[model samples]
Target: MREAAPPKQLAFDLPLDPRYGREDFLVGPANEAAYGLIEAWPRWPDTVCLITGPSGSGKSHLASIWATRSHAWTVPASEVTADSVTHLVSNGALVIEDIDRPEGREEAALFHLLNLARENGSPVLITAAAPVEALGLVTADLRSRLRLAPGATILPPDDALMRAVLVKLFVDRQLVVDLSVVEAIALRIDRSLARARAVVAELDRDALRRGRRITRPLAMSVLADLGVPDDETDEDDAPA
Candidate 1:
């Protein structure tokens, strides 16, 4: 007996977007101000700023772009400490990520880092998934400073952002998907950068295994297979 042939796959070999620079960051009403503010750089209203958004929003991306523009070092929330702060702020700026995640005594260190960075004239960009006040920081001064900043939140992606995100995800994966299929998928999915990214990843795998093009019907099938229902139906797909 002859051995069976393996499944045919459409190779989608490409790196994630490397141009996460200011120019590469897409802008729409939802994230326009946040984009502009971060781009403003070295001219922030305050030494420290809070950028809040839902998990899939582009808070981290904006932070990354600012990090590049400001030539800042990046530190995870868990690693923030007085000792680490001095080293991280050597560049006169730093990107402190995941300030929303609760960790023991970590926020207090952030409070000190904020003051120290301000004293050193180094600005800090703080990214959170929730409102700045809602992170449950135990330090009162930290809370006060954050409240004073009263930062901007990256709202969920709008239609234009959603479509652009979908196309970018597909292109990064080196998969050329039809616009109709992208719109079909976008309408059915939650409007978030993360959701757009996740849907593309899932569809990429499904297409490779099934040898199917990323099309409207295939998108419908994949959405079902992922147990993510097409919550809103598109009139274009409906019968006359």
Candidate 2:
């Protein structure tokens, strides 16, 4: 008789690290254009700024930095309402996130807020995975206004960006990993900001459990466990 192994239990130690300021943002060729725009501040070409990119591409990170520096009141679409937007706008700047759909009353409210912000000379920042035209917003006027908004699309990270991101992630966690360890995993990671965070969290937990500093071999094992391809696979399975 054989017994099946139980699944590994996951830890829920979500430590809050207050290090997501502008200094934490890594600049690279892929995102330098967007960074340039963010750095422009209130002098941007338009009153509204849209940041679009693929998931885990650092759009949200850049948006957060801008929000902090601008002191903009950032809110998710779910929290926005016809009543709340006025106060939010009156106080200062504003940001609306998660505009996946414009079916709710919030969409109309966002439209009102945008128009209001434009008239009042306040800049609005938005983040979305899809382009402005592809959102299929229910409100026609909001769509038109968004069309006029000046924004930037962040591209996928190149090798330099990946290295910087991986190294930064480790530093954020206060890990003592070396550059070689970072290099080995950065090239093998799934190439998404989301994946980078997940792998780093897992590695931190695993290293703590094993009472070891993160090393190249440990990074490889973590990548392997996460189903990321190994360097050996390219040669091991190559055509002979």
Candidate 3:
């Protein structure tokens, strides 16, 4: 007789696409400034405004909200080019995202787009991981133009914001987790929406793999597996 095969480990790895609707965004102190800037719209301090934050800090969500309200299309940094500036400006308003990722010839193209957008009275919203000064753009004119645009920065999440983010992430994944579980994990992890997302994903995967429901013990085990230490100090030490 053939030997029995080992059990296969199960996984739930479906992609989770977050909803970018205005109502879907969670507002907290960390991102209120950025949210307000997006809400201010054409009344913005300048025709161009920049929003900066760490990865997964809701920069794209804020940009999406603005794009919808302004009836503008979004162009990634890599896609901005001299050849596309005319068509980009034709959109009446624009959002250029992830400017930190410089691609071939992107510096000159972005400079051209900015100039054309200004001349045509089209408002532009730009998002990056860092401010204009830190992007290290070789184009002098582009640097000058970017600096002119007023900017908002989204700080990391606080305890309340992190808990809220965890709840939202669970809802986005259609997981009905208990409040205690949310509270338990929120205290242990760093103050990052990205980290919250990772934790939730890991817990979901672990629960599914074990063919068990998500519970406090499972959450703790998953947290340990992910190397997230339990420290309440994160709440007290949140950024101001």
Candidate 4:
């Protein structure tokens, strides 16, 4: 049997936030249309858009992209209220994230903001964890209005996409990782792209702690210690 590679010392510094600009977001079958829509926002500034996906599925990243590229302002769902809608609408191009969390005053404010933006021909983007129809809004008008906004859903990234995401993240952090290590990580971790990111972050932390390189054994040890399994097999393909 081939001996496992020695535990290489990973040169890890303090963690950096993952880069999620247009360059970092991989475009595959899963999110190509959503990416395209974001890219086209400048040309269609009057089009109101709604983007929905699971938590950590890059909703805020997309919003940031629009904010930077189109000079749009972003408001958190919790801070919005009827009183503040007019000020937020003044931004002309706006993004509201976590729409599902706002209730009572905040929800009403969001509805009014949407109406005001529409009337003014200002572009607005709303992000949520679920589709508008599933938001469970108490106000019928709010539900009906949201249902009319053009919307897109970002599907979770698949294995190949996850591997690409990890490679890009490590490279952005200036860490040199072997292809075998990348493949091993992509194959072993949970399917969620977000989870893959967290695992790499943890691995980086472990390497920093030990002042060592990241090798198969080191990764396994760190993941196991964190309660992440080390089965070295893709759960999507394994026999039940």
Candidate 5:
């Protein structure tokens, strides 16, 4: 008789739309300043604000909060264009997200948006993974204007923040993990918000595959599969 095929992978994943409610945000020293800036809102020192941080550093989360409060229109940097600048600025508030190294095509458009927002007295929030000077924009006017905007930089997450982020990520995936499991993974993996997201996603997939609840062992196995340091694993797994 032919050998039976192995079991097929299951696809029982739910929509992982992150909770962007003000209450869902876990503020810590790493991002308190940025959070404060977002909360400041209409009282901002200028019409434009720049929030810079590493990927998964909650830039978008804060922006979402601001958008909700200010009724701002949101658009990615790549999608911005000279033609859309007028329409985007008319919204009274706007968020231009992920202004990473640009191709210069949108430089004129962004510069125009900034000018229009300033003229119309509308508030604009711009987020980026790097500083304005590092975005590689070829337009000097845009570069200078972006530099003038009051900016808040979010530092990497601390231990407490890391643990909280892990919990939130698990919650986002609708996975109910114990504090022990969350703490174990938080202490073992790299202290990065991006890494936290990746770990949670991987754990969710692994748990779905095994049809088991998220446990310490399952988290450990998923971390190892994700190439987390073996020494880190050994230290965490050791008896107290």
Candidate 6:
């Protein structure tokens, strides 16, 4: 039997939301350990885990996975309070994202929640842009406690990883993308998974609007419009 052809891409509204999941998140040496930790959450010795990564590194996507898997509740850093912690947790796992931004009161509440979760045997997962040591907290105990939690850092994806991620994004959306087009975008755009995602998303919108496939020409035009310098195009002219 022959393999079936993939489905065609669909036109949809622009996705302002960031994409994250096992399927969309590309694994490379940069993030393999973190990926492993996330996948092995079921076997994690401590219920509490701290995931830290640069912005646009897909922390929220990982949190979504854990939330679904562990029936975890998420409390935005701004909304965290001692009372809210009790209500939000309600015996379920907790995923606290952007912990570094919480105010003093929120910090206090988070500290209390950590202690509560540890005592009750419930798990707590926290994510921040920076490591726990970098987040200056007013409470000594909370800072010390957070420092003790196992930390997972998501390293930035490289050009190859970014290209693969872009290809996957287009594939997921049913968009047709040739390898040349993928390479062009990957080479020219800001070298970050977040930037690659944004570029692909914008190209997807532009392609739908123009009723055209995602070709190198279209990708270049979109990148140019986005103000990304066309240095990659000129690289070929450099003396060997």
Give all TM-scores, in the order shown. Answer: 0.89, 0.85, 0.90, 0.85, 0.90, 0.84
lDDT winner between candidates 3 and 5: 3
Better of 2 and 6 by lDDT: 2
Task: Write candidate 3's Cα lDDT for 1-240 as tens digits.
Answer: 999654546795988878999999999999999999988877887888999999999999999999999999998888887788899899899998999986654787888888888888899999999877789888898899888789899999888889888998888888888888898898888888888889999988887777777888888889888888766543334678
CA RMSD per model (angstroms)? 3.3, 5.2, 5.3, 5.0, 3.5, 6.6
* TM-score-sorted candidate list, best first: 3, 5, 1, 4, 2, 6
Q: Which candidate has the highest TM-score of all?
A: 3
lDDT of 6: 0.78
State model 1's lDDT. 0.81
How big is the positional error of residue 37 in model 2, measured in Å on the Cα after superposition? Answer: 1.2
By TM-score, how accurate is candidate 3?
0.90
Which residue pairs show collisions in model 5? none
For model 5, state the Cα shift of residue 194 in Å. 2.0
Runs off by more than 4 Å, candidate 4: 1-15, 43-46, 103-105, 233-240
Least well predicted 10-residue stretch by lDDT in candidate 2: 229-238
lDDT (10s digit) by residue, model 6, range 5-91:
555556677555545555666688767777777888878878688888888787888888777788888777767786687776675
Tens digits of lDDT, candidate 1, 1-240: 999776787656544554576666788999988888887777787888888899868887898888888888887788987677677777888888888888734766787788888899888888888886688877888888888873788988889889998888788778988788988987888777887787888888888877777888888888898787766867785878
Q: What is the C-alpha lDDT of each candidate?
A: 0.81, 0.79, 0.87, 0.78, 0.86, 0.78
TM-score of 1: 0.89
Cα deviation of 49, candidate 5, in Å: 0.5
- Order the numbered candidates by lDDT, best leading: 3, 5, 1, 2, 6, 4
Off-target runs (Cα >4 Å) in candidate 1 are 1-19
Model 6 scores worst on lDDT over the 10 consecutive residues at 14-23
In lDDT terms, which candidate is top? 3
Candidate 1, residue 96: lDDT: 84
lDDT of 4 by residue, 1-240 (tens): 999755646555655866657777787767777787788876763457888888877788888888888788887887778778888888778888888874543667777887888898889888999988788788888898878777779897887788888888777767787777787777777767678778888877777667676786777777788777776664433689
